[model samples]
Target chain A: MQRLFAIIGDPVKQARSPDVFNALAAERGVDAIMLSLHVGAEDFAGVLDGLSGVRNFEGAVVTIPHKRAAFLQCGSHGRAAEAAGVANVVRKTGDGLHGDLFDGFGMVNALRRAGVEPDGRSTLVVGAGGAGVAVAFALAEAGAAPIQVRDRDTDRCRQLVHQLTQSGYPACEFADDFQGLRLVVNCTPLGLDPADPLPVAPERLDPDCVVADAVMAGRATRLTAAASARGHAVVPGEEMLAGQMPAIWSFFGLPGETDISAAKR
Target chain B: MQRLFAIIGDPVKQARSPDVFNALAAERGVDAIMLSLHVGAEDFAGVLDGLSGVRNFEGAVVTIPHKRAAFLQCGSHGRAAEAAGVANVVRKTGDGLHGDLFDGFGMVNALRRAGVEPDGRSTLVVGAGGAGVAVAFALAEAGAAPIQVRDRDTDRCRQLVHQLTQSGYPACEFADDFQGLRLVVNCTPLGLDPADPLPVAPERLDPDCVVADAVMAGRATRLTAAASARGHAVVPGEEMLAGQMPAIWSFFGLPGETDISAAKR
Candidate 1:
């Protein structure tokens, strides 16, 4: 039977997950497809209830406002989801639905793929929403020190820093400035609209500093472009998204790249 | 945004709606795909409730055990659905979900397409299940008279005949035998398994009696094969399913054949 998976969020039209996941599934000859399901926050629980009844519904990728709600719904959680208090991916297990956070993993993976090690790096994480908190936790887990968190909502930013401190991550604090940070990751939505300003002043960063944006625009985000022009290495959000696919595919029990490669040989 | 549609049934792996609907949707360049959702009878209402919360879920093709349940859940019904007391297709309307029966329409449409008109023809419909009732009502609406309905369950068979007669379809009665029928349609699961006996003996029908089977076995059913070998016109279940696509597509507000043709030019 062809298994059903969905990326659930409100205003889901711009989601690239269906295209990305479907293409990978097709390439691997898996009998599955990921769909973009536009569902409001109010209807999240009800929709999950309905989807649970479908035996062929293997899993779903939760996005945006639904991530935290999905985390709450799961019977169990991965370490990353537990740390971030949110879930971006869910799989139906024998016992029940298992939720996990991949946003932080994706960000860290993207950085590693771009040849920037997070260990001992001074990191500044902008935005304290689900994605920002996830990135902060993952960076801390990857040995990034003195992680400075920033968000327009001061309370949310302080809460994230406090959570990181309580979790025993060293030197977690609110960002006072962009000074001396070796890695600056923007988890804000600033780059989504063309008219939106860059999340940080790239000029203030050291020329060797690496910049990453979580905004998944079709092209380069303003922050990434500005940082790149200044000769700093930049990671676009798409790479982070790509980094998450293998884990997501495996979570749903679909064949991964290695399996496909071996089968071909 | 890509729309989500589903064919919901118990034991749904055998269903061909996903293939057929997905192919047509692709041919028309519609951003929609139909998936097979396996939900047992007990979970039908819960699943429907969940699906209703999906903003992008335009409709569903309900099959087998869920047909009557779907009818009961619909806010309103088309004439055919009301007559059959079941729904095989449902669409989301501004008010709520509206359901309709297309099995009867599909059977009649297939017959007409195969150059065997049901108008004023004496028809014997086997199996008083959801598909059988739908086909019988459709045939009656298309001017097939003296409709003879039969099923192993005598009570269900008598109920369909009574309903048809009460709905003002003339000469509706329970079948005693295959005698002198101009059209014979098998709506039972008899042909699905090759070991099962034919719903009716082909030798008992008149030489020119048109035969149709609602069983959608991949290959020709024994009844259709036998009737065809004996020089009778035959309509397979696939043709009936094909006949329903245009109406189903239209019901979901997707572009129809004419629109595709026009686009091609």
Candidate 2:
């Protein structure tokens, strides 16, 4: 029997997920298919109920807006989802829906693939939103030491630092400055627009640091470009996107096998 | 900003929706993305509620197991969705999820493109499920007369007849035989398997009849193959799929604006 699958979200036009998963499915020789679905905030409840009763479909990935909403829907969630209060993947089980957040793993995978070790490293993260929380958790999960969390919302920083420490990340502190860090990550939407200001000044960045930005739309962010000029190894958002697929595939009970180099070719 | 979308279903991996919609989105110069989401039956309600709050996604396409569920989830349904008791498209409205069934339009569009006029024409449809309901409605919408509906479950046929008549169709009746019909449509899954029996006896099919099957997976069913041998004009499931895209796009408020053909190339 053929297995069916779909992604649910509104404004579903800009996602690269179809190309990404379709290619992976074809390579795996699974008789499964994926599609784009549009659902608005008001109708999300009905659509979710409608989808579960449908016989053929097997899996789904929850995107923004829905991620936090999904955290409450699933019967249970992973630790990351609990801490971050968002879920990016929901797996269908015989009993109920099982949800887990993979955004943090995506970042970890990206950094590992780039030969950057967060363990025994001092890292600074910008932004305290969903992406920032995931990135901080990932850095902690990978054994980053003495992590500093920063955000325009100082309260958010304090809250995240508390959560990070509780989650067993190394000693955490609140810092508004970018100094003496082996790595830096920007998770806010600040760099998405061309006119957006730099999350951090270039002069404060360590030339030997590895800089990463969670913003994905265009070529390079002002932050990453400046980091590149400083001779720092920079990781692109696409790298994180590519890195996340394997773990996501695994979470969905898929084969979870993908060769990033081969895919790029 | 790039738009995001998802197809919500259980067996999401098997859907071809992502390929079709993403291709169209690319051709239309719309910065949109689509993905497949898999949610289970039990968690449908929670998941739907969660999705409604997502900020980036605009719309989604609903499929099997979810169509009827989607119908109930809609804050409001169009005349078509209300009549069919199902929905294939759910768009986010300012108020809530607004649903409309496009399968009927797809059937009508396919027939019109193939130069098959249903007005005052005699047609026999061999299924009473969702696809059959849509086709029956489309035939009525096309002004067909004396449309015959048949299903293995006699009650379903009677109920569908009642539904169709109430929805303003012209004289729908139940017929078990395929004799003296100008057009024959197999809306059931009977002919999907290559080894399955023809939905109707070939000898009973008119030589000049229009035969159409909603199956797209493999070669033509025995009925269509035999009908073709006898010089009948055959409509494949692909035609219905192609026919539906324009209307589906239109439902998303994209309409003829999406360049589907160019994207596929």
Candidate 3:
């Protein structure tokens, strides 16, 4: 049977998951395609209810504002989703809809792919929003110690730090500076506009530090470009997206990356 | 913005609308794809409600057991849908979801395309089910006089004949045989199994009569093949489906056939 998947968000035209997953499905000869469904916040519950009735609707990549709503709607959640209080991926199982948070895993996996193991590394996660929270928890789970979180919203930043500490990652704290950080990830939207300043000054960071930007753009963001210019190992937002594809694909119980590659041959 | 469309039915895997509409959308650069949604009768209402909430969901091709349900759910209907009390297509409008039946028009159009104008022709429609009713009404509307409808279920057959008569198609009546019929259409599931007998005896019909089958098969239906073997004009089920594409596309307010060609160039 041909299965259906969707990447659902309010303004869904900007989503790349449909293209990525659909291409992978086609290449692997999987009888499935991921579509971009533009569903608003108000319609989320109804849409979710409706999609559940579709027998072949196997999974969905929840994006943007729907992630939190998706997390709330799931009957069960993975540890990553529970820790982040949000879900970016959802799959239908015999037990019902299962949700998981993959943003942090994606970032961590991307770093690892770049030969920067997050385990035992000092990391700074900028922005206390959904992405930052997810990344911080993921890194913590990966054994990264002394995780520092920063955001313009002091209460939000403090809340994340508090959550981390309460969750037993006692090394987590609120950061005021970039000192001694080996892995610095900007989870803010600062680099979306060319006129915006870099989330953090690359000059203040050590040359060996891995600097990553979460703001996806057509080309390198200002922070990524500056970090690259400073000779620091730079990971753009696309890497995080690319890193999550296999994770999400596996979460859906479709073929894994290795299986897909084998199938391709 | 990209739009979404779906063909909804219980066993939707066999539906060709997705391939047909998706191909048309791609050829016209419409930034849309039609997916097959398998929703059982029990889930139809919830699914329809969910689909309506989708901001980019422009329309759906209703198939099988859901056509009448779609009709009942629609806020408004076109004349064909009203006449048939069923809808094969539904489109979103500012007023709400509007539905229309194109099966009848499709059959008539297919016949016209094959150089057999239905106007003033005496036609016999086998089976008084959804497809039969739709085709009979469409043929009547196309000026095919003295429409004769037949079915094993005498009650159902008489009910359809009554509906046509009540709707001012007084020339319509219950059919007992192929006598005096200039055109004959098989609207039942008779041809689905190769072992099943033909819906009508092709030898009993006039040599100049036209034959059409609504049973979609991998190859020609027995009735159509036998009729064609006897030198009668025959229209296969695929032609009915092909004929409806432009009508359904136009109903959705998408680019028309001529406009699509112009855009393609």
Candidate 4:
């Protein structure tokens, strides 16, 4: 029987998760289809209740306003989600719904694929929001040393650093200088608009640094574009999306890592 | 934005509505998809309540064990559904969910396509199930006189005749003979299994009659095969299914009749 999967969020019309997964499923001849559902916060509980009746319904990618709410709905969360306090992917388990935080793992996976080892490297993570927090935790968990967590919001930044320190991860204070940092990531929404200033100035970074942007653009973000021009190995947002799918497919109970690029054929 | 349509029933795995409508939707470049959902009896009420929260859900084809249950869910029924007290299709209108019966319309529409008229013709309709009753009502509405409705369950059969007669139709007693009847229809489950008897023996039918079997077969049912062998103009079950699509597409708020065969290419 064909199984149904969905991406649930308020502004789901813009989501390409369906296209991404559907292309892979069709290529692999898997009996599955994923669709985007524009479910608002107000309708979240009811939608979950209704999905109980949808026997073939597998689960969903919870985004935006529903990520935290999805975590609350699940029976349990994976270590990353429990630590980060949010869920980006949700799946139906034999007992009930299960959730996991994949942003951190996805970014690490993307970097690792590009031949960058996160361990024992000094890093500057720019953002105190969900993605930034996940990135910092992943970097810390991967044995990176002296990880700096920065954000425009001081309270959120303090909270993230505090959480990492309390959890015995290698999170630390921000270094005022970024002259020789091995890794730098823009987890903030700064890269979405070309007019916005770069999360970190191009002149201040090491030319040998590995830079990544969480926000997707039509092409490379201003930060990534500048980083690439400076002769640094820059990872675009698309790579992060691709890296995320393997983890998502596992949560969805499909057999291991999917090569989404090759699956397009 | 993409719209979602579904077929709701307990035993819906065999339903071809998704295949039929999805083909047309893709052919016309309509931003719509039709999927089958298996909603069981115990979960019916909750499913309806929950669907109200499904923002992209447009409509559904309500099938077996749920048709009459669907009538109860509708805010109002169209003429045919009201007359038959059941609905095979439901659409989301601005005000609420509205329903209509298409089985009767489908039969009349099918016969008309084949250049056969039901008005002023004597017809024998087999079975007293929902489909049979709807067919009889449709025939009566189309001006078929002295309609004979028969079934093994006499009370249910008598009840159908009473409803038609009380509602000002020309329905009458079922006759034991079919020698001069202009049209003969089998709306029963008899033709599905080869071992089951035909609704009406082929030996009693007039050689000039137009015979139709509502139950589908891999090719032709024994009754249709026999009728064709005897030189009677036999309408296969496929035509009835085709005839139903116009009504279903209309209910789903799409434009005009769908040529399902051409859509496959």
Candidate 5:
């Protein structure tokens, strides 16, 4: 029996999931097909209604705008989805559609795969959006100590810190400045465009710290370049995308352990 | 400046659009990036809100669940999107997002590329889902003399007939069986699995008919295989996916002139 999976969104043409999963599926000899679905907000309910009736479509990977809805739609959700109020993956269990978030898992997996474990490390993270939240939660779970989160929106930073600690990381804190931080992550799109400035003051960065930017600009992002120039190792956004695939495949009940680093080769 | 294109869906990972578009973009000198977005049903408004505020992202390809919403959300829709009451592509303009559907275009392009024009020919399309509607519309627009549509639901067949004529195809009709139809299309998943029954009874198919199955089963679908055994020409679903690239690219304000069939070679 062939398993069917779909990635649904409003403008669904640019999705890489179908190829990624299908590639893995083909390698695994599983008769599975994955397709991209363009779904709009108004049609979300209807699309779900239609998908719910289809037995072959075994799973779905939820993205922006729908992550929160995915959490609510599922009969049950995992702890991370419940905490972040978002879901990056869903599966059709015997009970119903089960939703869970693998965003944090992707982040943690990326860090671990890169041999840069955040456990017990003092970390400084910039930006507090969706990816940032996932990263923060993942770092907390990874045993990172005293992780400092910064965002232009102080409230969001405060909320992330609260969530991180409430979720069981006792060392979470809000950082108004980047001092005494060893691991720095820029999760904002500040460096995606050539015109955008570094998310943080270059002079303020610790020379020995490891920096990672969640932006892909062909080459190193300004933040990554700056950090590298200052003798710090940097992780690119592609690494994060690659790191998330294994968990994603598992989320879909598909086989294949993915190493995003291998994809770079 | 890199051109921005996107595939929007609630769960966007399961999409080949990024690979297809990125490969196309790499082949060209155009600095462009294709990405997937996960948007939820209620988040449609929020997605539009986000798109309006962004600078780099330009156009998007809509997918299932969001097609009807895209049709409703667009400032204006083309004849095909309007006819089907759905859209698979949306180009952002100064006025707003303009919607069109390339599903029909893909089928039309495939037939034209294969030297089998839908115009003035008899077409028997099986299934009445989104793909069927698009194929039917394309055939109707291309001036097919008589088009026959059938679905499990008789009302759906009636609805298709009404929509086809409303779109200016006067010769549209519903048929309970494939008698003298020159073209046979299996738009349903009936032939998806190796075990699934052929959409059409093999003995009922005309040996001279052109059989096309939209279900991609890695080999000829049971319908197509049966057609081949009976000395009929066959079209695969993968061809449809490949054929839609050019028109879809053009609709996105990108160059899709390169034949997608060549990609297979």
Candidate 6:
């Protein structure tokens, strides 16, 4: 039987997960399909409960408002999600549901795919949402030190920093100091629209810092474009999505699927 | 977002509903996918409840043991399913789930497509299983008076006759008499397996009577092959499936899809 995979989120029509996943599956003969399940936030848990009846429903990728709620449904969590207290992936194991966060790991993998590592690097993340926390957790795991987080939601920023500190990483507050940073990541939706401001002042980014943005669709966010113009290495969100698929596919036990970045199908 | 449709049954993998439905959807540029959901009879209710979580789920096509059980979940029943007390199609409408059965209607349509009409014909349906009952009901509705039904299970045979009689159809029990019959249909699993016996004795069939088998996997079952070898016209189960699609697509509110039999997609 063909397996069913779902990406559940409110307003999920914009998510490119299904586009890339389905293309990769078809190109590689995976006999699988990924659907963007635009479930309302209020119905997230009820929907999960109901999905138990779908015998071929292998797993679901969680996003946005449901990230935290979906995590509660998982019986186990990967260390990355455990540290971040957020999940981007959920798998159905024989025993039960297992949750993991891939956004952070994918970012690190994207960096490696781009020929860089987080060892001894100073990093700044501008968002305390699920993606921001995942990036911070992954950076810590990759040996980044003194990670800084900022968000318009001050409480969320403080909460993320506290979560990072509890996870035993050398963490600090973002004070707009990007001069000597080796990496600068934007986890917010600051550059999603044409009129939106960049998450940070692109002019302040150090020429050596590798700039990355998690908001995809636009491909080159203002921050990345400006950083690229200034000769700084830039990582696009699309690359991160591709990088995450290897881990996500492994979670689905379909690891042979070719990388979407390489397949481009 | 792409809509989700499911075919629910224990042995659902072999059903060609997904193949034709998905093909029609793709051919017409409709954003939809039909999945084969293998659910045990025990879990049928649970699965239907769970499917409620799928916000994009439009409805499901039911087969075999679960058809009657599924109709119970429908808030309303279309006239055909109501008359037959069974549903092969369940659709999500603004009012709620609406159940309908197309097997009978499809049989009549298939006969018409094959250049034969059930009007005023003497019909005998072998096997009083779901398919058998459906064909008998359709024959009755098409004005085949004194419709005959036979089954290995006498209770079921009696039950279907009673149901048809209650629906104001001229129905009776099969007395192993096929003389002068214009139509003979095999609706049971007989001739499904190579070792299984033919549903009816070909020697007893009138060479001028039209024969049909509702089991399609083998397309030409022993019953159909024998009837054809004996110089009788044969209608394969594929026609029944094709005839059913028009009603199914209309139930899904996608009536513009050309007949899949004509499209052969």
Top DockQ model: 1
Please list the residue runs of candidate 1 whose C-alpha ends up more than 4 Å from where it truly belongs after superposition.
A151-170, A188-203, A217-233, A257-265, B151-170, B174-177, B189-198, B217-234, B258-265
TM-score of 3: 0.84
Candidate 1 residue lDDT tens string, B6-49: 98987677776777788887777888888889999999989988
lDDT by residue for model 5 (A55-134), tens:
45588776545666777788888877777666767888888778887766776666777788888888877888776887
Cα lDDT tens digits for candidate 2, A143-218: 8877888888988888999888786776465565566788888888766667899987767776777888877644
**Chain A TM-score for predicted structure 6:** 0.81
Q: Which residue runs does candidate 4 get wrong by more than 4 Å?
A: A112-121, A126-133, A151-159, A162-168, A173-239, A255-265, B111-121, B127-130, B151-169, B176-241, B255-265
Q: CAPRI band of model 3?
A: medium
Error of 2 at A122 (Å): 3.2
Candidate 6 lDDT tens digits, A89-168: 88878877899899988888888888889878999988988889888888888998879988999998999889888879
Pick the TM-score winner.
1
Minimal lDDT window, size 10, model 1 chain A: A256-265
lDDT of 1 at B251: 81
Query: Arrange candidates by lDDT, highest first: which order?
Result: 1, 3, 6, 4, 2, 5
Residues A207-232, model 4: lDDT tens digits: 78899887756478899998898898
Itemize residue pairs with steric clashes in candidate 6.
A50-B50
Runs in model 3 deviating more than 4 A are A113-120, A128-130, A141-145, A151-170, A188-209, A215-234, A256-265, B113-120, B151-170, B188-210, B215-234, B256-265
> What is the CAPRI rating of model 4's predicted complex?
medium
> Can you tell me the DockQ of model 1?
0.82
**Could you give the candidate ranking by DockQ, starting with the highest?**
1, 3, 4, 6, 2, 5
lDDT of 4 at A223: 94
Provide per-model DockQ scores. 0.82, 0.16, 0.73, 0.60, 0.07, 0.56
Write model 3 residue lDDT over B1-265, tens digit each, in one string. Answer: 5788888876566667667777788777888878889899999989989988888999998877788999999999998788778898999888778999989878887787788999999888899888898898888889897888888998888999898888788555555666778999999878767889989899899988999998766478888889999999999887776678777787888875633222111
Worst 10 residues of 6 chain B by lDDT: B256-265
lDDT for predicted candidate 2 compared with the true structure: 0.72
